[model samples]
Target: MIRYVHMYLVAILLVAGISMSFPSGRHSKAEAANDMSVHAKAAILVDAKSGKILFGQNMDESLPVASMSKLMTQYLILEKIQKGDLKWDDVYHADATDQDLSTRPGLGNVPLYQGQSYTVRDLYNAMTLVSANAASRALGRMAGKSDKHFVQMMNDKAKQLGLKHSSFVNTSGLNNQDLAPYQVKGTASDGENKMSARDLALLAYHFIHSFPNEMDIEKKELDQFPVTDSYSIPLRNKNQLLPNGKYPYKGAIGLKTGMNDAAGYGIVALAKRGQRELIAVIIDAKNKKGKRSSKARYMQAQKLLDYGFTHWDYQKISPEKFLPTNQQKIPVENGTKEKAAITSKTTVTELVPKNSHSIKAKLTLMPKFLTDQKKRELPSTYQPYGLIEVGASRVIPSNDRKLTELTLSFRKLLFFMLISVIPHF
Candidate 1:
């Protein structure tokens, strides 16, 4: 009699542990992530190939993105050029107004003559390397046939790109001083462009994947001299991550940079080593004690990229590797033999940290044989409760090198186990 009771008690404990894997929870949100100490108000890191958000903080908060908006204009230019609507050798004439705006103090520009013309190739080089406002506006005119039409196209592209929180106010993001020349109705009038860190990283990802060939120019800074029909125009790349720039990081590559009083210093930064590519964004990283530091944004972005590369890697994890059998059968409360079977939901084989370990499976199975009509035959004092909702359960797809995370609530499992079985207790 004693030995039989001990065996039954052991089965009860095992079944309780399984139910505890997941139970009804009253919590509303996930716990906070570990500290990274990133100074940017909003930041995110995304895997280039998988499009997975490896790290994020305030990723959906829309904020100004200064010169970074230029990437959109750059994308449109590349698309038009690729589709044969525009050619590299085609001429673009910067009117007298464009020249005047270029010469404006804080507005980045390369000189142009009113009547003189520049090849499409020269304008692209200037825009990517120097982030020239005049260069972007000229490309905008060509892409959309006018500045207003170009702004519309930018918004349209943002929608198509699935940028729910991104909108462009201008091509170059030079919203300083008098608004007369730069004003475009319906766009952010302050010359500020707004995008969440996630959306900005998505933009960079879209640009790189769509026009893989164009990244060559952004990999480094260069002295550019695009000659007009009348004079030579001098330009230099301003992105600090470039080889010749002040804070050049070894793996940093092509993208764009933007800054204004409102947007602070920001970069849509990309880095590659071996086969791994990472896209990181840091926006509104300002030094409150003094004036804003351009290097802060760059350093933050570099920090994120380095952390992702160093701590994160891909590995395959299978529950079967750790379990005696992938499937198990448990007994119903009154059954003489185990009839209900449960198996590991899925395996995880996607990008995980170097230290990631296999997760233990805790699953509860209810026999399909028990029906409502059968339950009525039991004593009124006996209550049965083991409700499983497959749809609501945490089931991650383990195919195609993807990782499905698993979580269990031991408390709920224990409650279900003790209540459904052990009728006398």
Candidate 2:
């Protein structure tokens, strides 16, 4: 039941990864509004439905992703929850080994008494909503063999997911040696995580698509964390877009946030409108420290989300016209009055705004279609070469006349022949 359908299909459609170039003036009035004036080291806007890179700037540039990397940590832990390996109510014992990097005065952390145990749900909530370093480290250690070994698991997972532009040095996104104790002492790695906006977006997109209900853990309140002793610590969601925040954007969901002198301010924000859920990765926002909290990141994320909603329209690319469609029913050989129907195999999403012209989805048909009937043969690779031009609402076919004619007539004879061409975004 480990399905790789989407990943496999995406690989086939893309000879390369997402295109990095930003859209030009030819786009619609709304799409052209993508003219962004923002501050960040790297940023990207992605359509979760189609895996389309709606917008990117310095997206491929690798840099410390800060606590944004914790989203991946949360992902690994959630995977265990989804399986039978871990449960929400399961309690873990916190000891000297669990003692975090610092007793920093105001740092987001839940104090633990020796020999006391806390539920996995409490640790998870603290990690997700408050961005607690100790919570994340504890979870990694508990989930994997050790904090050091778990860092290995993180990198291995990154390779398996095809995150080429990412590398993990620690489970918790801490750069200072004093902060992360999980890493072996005297190791070369300073314990900082690095990833490009595109790679981070891919990981977040996969997480959102795979675990729908489990992600609800983020919406919890700070006061919800259980208090073991007289120390009653309350921590609010660092993501300001969520409810009861300084600047609550409509439809904003609770996401992770990170900040440090080197990493600056960063966030991976998610929002949904009807069927579309947009993921915006804003990294390395300017930091005046307390004077400017994570507001700049939240504001930039809102802008990107606004652009995605205003600019694009989704349309399904089907091959009904490219392939011949019989009138209601096509008679089947050696069968009753029942006739078979012809349908296209390609059903994909393409993001093109309304009234946009000049965008084309060119399909390169294989050379076999151009030869004579006697000499005609499919590519030795055995892949379909039919082409589809994608646009706002049109799927323009580009193929040799002989191939078109043969397909139209032959399609009527075969009851269940599927159209070979796939409409990729």
Which is the leading candidate under TM-score? 2
Q: Per-model C-alpha lDDT, please? A: 0.62, 0.60
All candidates' TM-scores? 0.69, 0.72
Candidate 1 TM-score versus the reference: 0.69
lDDT of 1 by residue, 7-79 (tens): 1100122222111111121111111233455678788776775455566667777898888888888989999
Name the lDDT value of residue 147 in candidate 2.
Answer: 77
Number of backbone clashes in candidate 2 = 4
User: Candidate 2 versus the native: TM-score?
Assistant: 0.72
Which residue window of length 10 is worst by lDDT in model 2?
1-10
Q: Residue by residue across 281-363, what tens digits does model 2's lDDT show? A: 88887543433347788877888889878866665544343332333223332223233333333354555553454333322
Error of 2 at 194 (Å): 1.0
